[model samples]
Target: MATAAKKESKPNAGFMKPVTPSKILAEVVGTEPMPRTEVTKKVWDYIKKHDLQDAANRRMINADAKLEAVFDGKKQVSMFEMTKLISNHLKA
Candidate 1:
């Protein structure tokens, strides 16, 4: 019998900063230090609350003023792309 290779888990970068208000994002949606995952979730909540998701294509999020700053001034981005944008706010 052949042994299966061990799976390596992606390490958590570090303890995620607690979600709080941020400066650049202050006007966008109130800046804060949240785990990368939580930040996205919160952004999605804002999107859903404001109906920012595209009706024709749900993957794209229409950036609001707050999101625009976080997204590097991007007006729109896919769900996958959102991750990269959110990462910029995360601090060590």
Candidate 2:
């Protein structure tokens, strides 16, 4: 049997760099600057904690008052669209 070399990987610098969240986004994710990855995690945490996902369609996230502001008044958004919307609120 032959042994194979293992590959090592590092996190992407762009994703690791800290970003400031917009005032609307701050309500859910906090006011502190955080990496994009952490912002996403915190947003998801808020969603899950608030039971914001649609019952029929788990892919859809129902926006609460705070999230609605971040979502630009959208009452609901798909999980895929959620990321795009969130990116708009992040400042480098």
Candidate 3:
């Protein structure tokens, strides 16, 4: 008789604690209280809709009125920088 060997299993993703949704931030731009994920989605939506993304400078996100408020009066922010700036508006 041959003995069988056990295979190691990968850890489950759900074991990690879920992130709590922070309180929504307000901007002159919209009334929706979107979570960070949703907010990011919406920002992309707006960017595409407005054709704000520069073809030459893909990293820069140009702000409309709503985005300006969320971005702390910045007319533009880098893609990576936007995430950090948005986090500031979320309540602890």
Candidate 4:
């Protein structure tokens, strides 16, 4: 009896495709078109750089003036909600 070879999983095409960020998002992530993964990374970088995460609750992200626009005027959002909010600012 022989063991079957493992199959590798490919990344989702949609996530890898380059997307343009809306003006509000561009202010945080820059104006260049980038993959969704990179956009998330950059957004997280900005959040970390600015110390925007809430001290009381690590999962909560406090929106600054620029981020408030991206977050649809929300003053604070959870880590999970952030991805959904950011999606609105990206276009294919």
- Candidate 2, run of 10 with poorest lDDT: 1-10
lDDT of 2 by residue, 14-78 (tens): 99999999988998999999999999999999999999999999999999999999888999999
Cα lDDT of model 3 by residue, 36-85, tens digit? 56656666777888987767899898887767777779898898988888
Model 1 stretches with alpha carbons more than 4 Å out: 1-22, 26-32
What does candidate 1's lDDT look like per residue over 16-80, in tens digits?
54655456654545555566556667677788999999899999989888788888999999989
Can you list the residue pairs that collide in candidate 2?
none
lDDT score at residue 11, model 1, on the 0-100 scale = 53
At residue 69, candidate 3 shows an lDDT of: 75
For 1-92, candidate 4 gives per-residue lDDT tens digits of 43457667899999999999999899999999999999999999999999999999999999999999999999999999999999999999
Worst 10 residues of 4 by lDDT: 1-10
What do the candidate models score in CA lDDT, each in turn? 0.73, 0.95, 0.65, 0.97
Could you estimate the TM-score for every candidate? 0.67, 0.93, 0.60, 0.91
Two-way TM-score contest, 2 vs 3, winner: 2
The Cα RMSD of model 4 versus the native structure comes to 2.2
Q: Where in model 4 is the C-alpha error above 4 Å?
A: 1-6
